[model samples]
Target chain A: MKFSELKKAVAIIGIALFVVVLSGCSGGDQDQEPGEGDQAVEEGLESAAGGETCASCHTDKKKLVADLDADPPQEVEKSEESEGEG
Target chain B: MEAEDKVLVAKEFLNTVHGQQGCTSCHGGVEPAASRKEAHQGMVAEPSAQKDSKCATCHADAAGTFEMTLHKTSRGIVDLDTGVLAARINPEKADLLQKAVDNHCASCHIDQCGDCHVSRPQWSGGGLIQGHVFQETPNPILNCTACHGSRVQKEMLGQGPSDFEPKLKPSVHWVPAGMQCVECHTKEWIHGPSTEAAVRYEVKEAPRCEDCHVDDTFYDNAYHKQHAEADPGKTLLQCQVCHSQPYNNCYGCHVGKDDKGLAYFKTDKSEFDFKIGRNPLKSQDRPYDYVVVRHVPVARDTFAFYGEDLLSNFDASPTWKYATPHNIVKVAPQAESCGSCHGNEAIFLLEENVAEDEREANREVIVPKPPPKF
Candidate 1:
């Protein structure tokens, strides 16, 4: 084959390989986005499905519901806003 | 009340409608992040601050009612105006007093729901009551009295300084019964709409001694029988007259701004004493001829840092005003003897009891010398 033709064929192969590699990386990331959350406490606890994992320890449904109905736990997590100022 | 205590969160709470919400839904800055630092970035220490965004969605009714609570508005101090300090101070000076309170005292007022329900009050250095569990009832020591330390908590717990000669007595109702503040001061009281009343006395449903000590024959005793017999012309007595013991009395409170313009408060002294005085507030609701009076440490110069002539009408109201000290005993020293209260010059707020300069402001609270014989 001619020298120019061989060079063009090699360039086309490199471009095709780059496109395939980019698609694979993007696809893998997109697949994992909704699968897991950052915190272990909220793992598998989806807003739509509700916090089913919480029931693992709090097995008493009646007592739990009563506690919530009468005095719902008002959870307060750490905040960046109040980071420096007490 | 300790800082190191790790409050456990109840797993059951997550099973309810509230649990259905994503942790980050109410508590932001956690979602779409990989690291702990990123999760807590821009997060709120108290999620209740976002009640409108977090709570109102699922629990609209309670969120609405909670907004109107006295805890939410923190208006109790506003009623301090009824006392001599606010009444006597010039309107402009009174404005400074408001400013002083807004900076120092007002922060203690309720800001969000989690302050009471979710976690220990932020004022006491916030900590968890349970291990991240949702609590139905608040920890009395941590949540309730941490902020009420000066009066209710200290008196009811019989806590005193190390130098105090005799240790103060705890409330009778507290020790054996183990009654929590929420028992008497119910959710209705906490969650009720703000009446904009300045003091607890103005709140119609202010917890009363009579609520538990019902006037039924089943519970009637010699003391009740004797006191319950109403006299047609005389002012009815309050239950605290005989039941309450001497409690902390603070005097000559002065608030000033330091050279750098930081606000600070100073008090002359604090003593434990009981004095019966004519009720400054003689409305139909409080028809007692004599009521317990405690000295508060508010002076004309309380807000001297803010401005001068702050409390020009200092004498317009009594220095020692009617009060309800939380230190209650079923049988106080005076309750056993008729003369302890009746014809007892020492117990009554006579002219001799108060400071010479304070007589003018305390005239209304001063009982007449000729005590009624029992």
Candidate 2:
């Protein structure tokens, strides 16, 4: 597979592992403090690529497209010709 | 940047040194935000614009004194217009010229650390080149040339063939040697020390030709043995006089407004030519009797659009200024034979070469006569 595809595959596997670990945590650690738990470390890792993080929208190429449904950045102005020299 | 909105970050970005901080660390936003807009509410596009930015928090030494550097302050350019030129003419209207400099000439130099390391300069279609990875060394093309493409880029890469000599090839350092700007212009030189040096030439740490080219490199050559010697009061030949190719020269600049009603500078003529003339910036450090000269894009009416008599005393300054062209080669046309340069008025900025209107301003730079046959 291409490098990008491989990365995507790894991301899918990581997501699967997070789901499995969260399921196991649901059964116990009810009294554990958030930061001290293995799940908290897992959550930290998840935050990097998680739905709530910058990576979520930024890494998703589909999030930005020229398609009709594509989302765009707000507050863009017509670019002016640059001025300045040495 | 038609797709300037598309910030498709890479998955591996989180593993980089800066990534570990999380997005909200440098770019402050409403974390666990009310909305996406709220999450980016306080996000700065180029954080390094501020002195004590996030980059400074970690890399304190460099960021601390960055503002004083010639690359940052561009104090020389501003100083010329508002200081020296003000004393020359229109001391009262320095305010308007200062305003013009701030809006136009100052834009390129206002660049910050991010403009070099993380993305292209803001003026040069800024965006992440490597998915927001922080480069230890700035990419020469993306960062350096983005602002300096006018001459340095063309000369260094030989992207521009010389008009004076159409057969001229790229710089030997670039075409065959494959040297990058960083090889000579080290990181320290680029970052600059904490000193408000008036000119880039004052930056002591900047590179010198002799620093790398040792004694033996020149001693073997007959031309080098005779003319390379420099002393306190004595003037020696500058390296570029023989080593560099004919480079670009700009003339007759007028600052005016376009259809959009925005202020801009337009050079009337940009030509490629080679000229040797007496050095005006001659000092102990640069005691060169004859050096390469290039016509700067300054005319009597340069600032006429702003107000009458703004640059009334423009003739006080030389239009043909000292230059160090970058298109260096092992053997140049001037180096072929002694006769090629001696008595060669074509290669010297003669009185006839000066434009009728600019002769007064360029009087010091115009060579009255050619050197006698060698």
Candidate 3:
């Protein structure tokens, strides 16, 4: 290969490597932003859930409706009788 | 008869005698009247324009002073239109001076002449004797002992020093100055409403020991300081210390063990040892032995710990996620968690008092382990 062409190819490769490293560093910065999912998980661990996890899901009307109507009476009755007057 | 009617009689008698003769003519009999009746008759027969003679018929000793007092010297007493006595005798005429004496003096004395005069030797005699007239005896001569008798007077006056005696004098300490019975006593009805009188005058409210000794707002800082300075180590000095009865001075509570484990609770110390069962659901079946616990030297950081079994059942774990060098139990709760038992402030103080070394020793004592199967 010609020496000039080899030097140009090597320069392109180095530029590409630098871009990858820069992106990797910025990726952690992106997670630090508020409203992100990872930040929410950190807050959840600090508060120890304390029933708030269940409350968050149960408070959603759609989810609550889905949970209530998902099972028919036959299935529910069977579970209740098996528990036996608990 | 109404006092007004009697005063009218007195006025008429005065007018009659004044129209005919001088004051000395009728009052001359005062010298010979050894009895009250004689003196009263002499006064009634010849009324005096000289107000002193009018009073002197009975209150002879008081007459000289009364003549000199503001009541007699001032025109306010005799001037029918403007005099206080005249108004009292005839209130419709706007004479306040007359009304004051008539309503105040005549109501009690009854006989107007007797209100002023004295005839009996025991009553008439004083230091103020002059020819045919008695002047006012000095206060020293007219002391309570004279009329009430020395023994009764001394008892009533209290075993106090005489007014003339110096307070700092060695002999005077035995007698306190002005400790007279009259200090608290008055001629007014003192025992309470007398059954004899249909309308009873309410007795005056007497001063309590606190009245003069304490200032207004005595509960405030200034007065309290004064009181403390005056009385060292005396109970009354630190009134608030006893009165406040501070409740924040102590800490105590209880803990209960259930099938799951143990939980702490704040409880009344008086009923500390009463067994409360492990499960709130089965409180009726009291199981574990009741232990009464109390924290000494109440501080801000006291705490109680729940057993592992109890924690597992309740799912209530302590706040500290990571174990410290002093805490052997993996999930040992912070002292603040026991606030239900030790109280918030007390728990804080207790935690503060626990030195690092002590905490380390305590941590060594507790070992985290799996529950042993029974």
Candidate 4:
């Protein structure tokens, strides 16, 4: 084969390799995002750590003590202004 | 002349003897004795000592029978040191016997015994000649025939011990075989310690059929159904009758219009029906034991009349009230109302379902491809 043809063949092979590597890398990245999306979906379905998280701040003992110390309101005070107005 | 003179002298001497001592008063024997004096001595001796034979002569029959009776034997044993004849006296019999002997011994010896002895008239109060008078206070004088005859005492008293022996009668009611009296009659007998037994044996306070039965599981089901049914005669409506299907998933409302061309509004009164599920504790698998739900409609407002619409409007915005754990009161929008069925967990996820997916999409979609701004 001629030397110039040999150069053209090597360039063609290099271009093919770059395209294959790019596609493979892109596919893996695309697959990872969907998995992350699935994880987020599952997490969203689960109840917010609302009650569970509050427990971390207010342990059983702390909650009991707070309950003991807290005075019950004598009557529900009428709102001077509606809180929900804002 | 000599004969006449002797006869006169003898007459004179006899007259003088009669005058001196009243004829044979001082003399002991008169005639039939070895001599005249011996006969007078027998006549003068104090009447020979009266023996017990005198009393026995009259009391022959009674003495004979009394000697044979257990009372006589007991008397002998009690007074063994006393003479044999003395042993005949039974203290228990003595009072009665002495009275009889004193009053009627002579009568008994004679044929007159039967007059008083045979079915004697019932005596009243105490009296002398009421021979062998039995004071029948509370107890009567019992004869041998009183207890001995085959049916004698039974007529006075009752049937024999065999009558008391328990015999099972054929049951009029259908009782399960081998069911003991104690099963239902728990306190019938004294079965335990004395105090416990006393408490148990009080028949008046003992449990009746209704005591364990009124609210028992077997009968209570029917009892409750009797009151609950709309038409009791038509249906033997039990809890299980209407609740044949176990769990129900409730839906808020219908989005589409019905044939009548009126929009349907879901109300707070809407409920899903449920039946008693299998007991969870009995299940082998824990996960499957969770309460299952199958959607069913309990109530629906089908008629779309103007009156119904007004009622719905009133229900939607009546004076607001606080919600209780047991009763929720609200007419939130349809989406918000889903919480009534799905609960808070699913309600929270509605927003997250769209939001979280959209955040990850990484490109915004504008309605159409926009030209780049100069």
Could you tell me every candidate's TM-score relative to the true structure? 0.74, 0.82, 0.18, 0.11
Q: Give stretches of model 1 more than 4 Å off.
A: A1-86, B1-20, B51-53, B79-85, B161-167, B218-220, B259-261, B370-374
Q: Candidate 3 local accuracy as lDDT?
A: 0.28
Candidate 3 Cα outliers beyond 4 Å, as residue runs:
A1-86, B1-143, B156-374
lDDT score at residue B4, model 3, on the 0-100 scale: 18
Q: Candidate 1's residue-wise lDDT over B21-129, tens digit each?
A: 6455666665544433565577665787764757667657667787766677666555345522456767755667677677656666777777777777776667655
| Chain A vs. native, model 4, TM-score | 0.41
Which window of 10 residues has the lowest lDDT sum in candidate 4 chain B? Answer: B320-329
Runs of candidate 2 exceeding 4 Å displacement: A1-51, A66-86, B1-6, B31-35, B80-89, B161-164, B193-196, B231-235
DockQ score for candidate 4: 0.00
lDDT of 2 by residue, B1-374 (tens): 44533255655666666766777777676455434566578877677886578888888878876767778877767775433354345667777777666665666674688888877788776868687778888887888888888788877876554334456667887889878888888878777663745667666776778888856666777777767775454447888998988877887676766667665776676777889988877877777888899888767777777777777677887888888887899888877899988877789999888888878887887888777896
What's the best-to-worst order under lDDT? 2, 1, 3, 4
Q: Write the per-residue lDDT of candidate 4 for residues B287-362, one digit (tens) a residue.
A: 1211222222211231222212211221221111110010011222212222332333321212232223222221
Candidates, ranked, TM-score: 2, 1, 3, 4
Q: Kindly list the per-residue Cα lDDT of model 3 for residues B221-274, writing each as its tens digit.
A: 543454334454532222221111111112232233334432223333211111
DockQ: which candidate is best?
A: 2
| Top candidate, metric TM-score | 2
- DockQ of every model listed? 0.01, 0.12, 0.00, 0.00
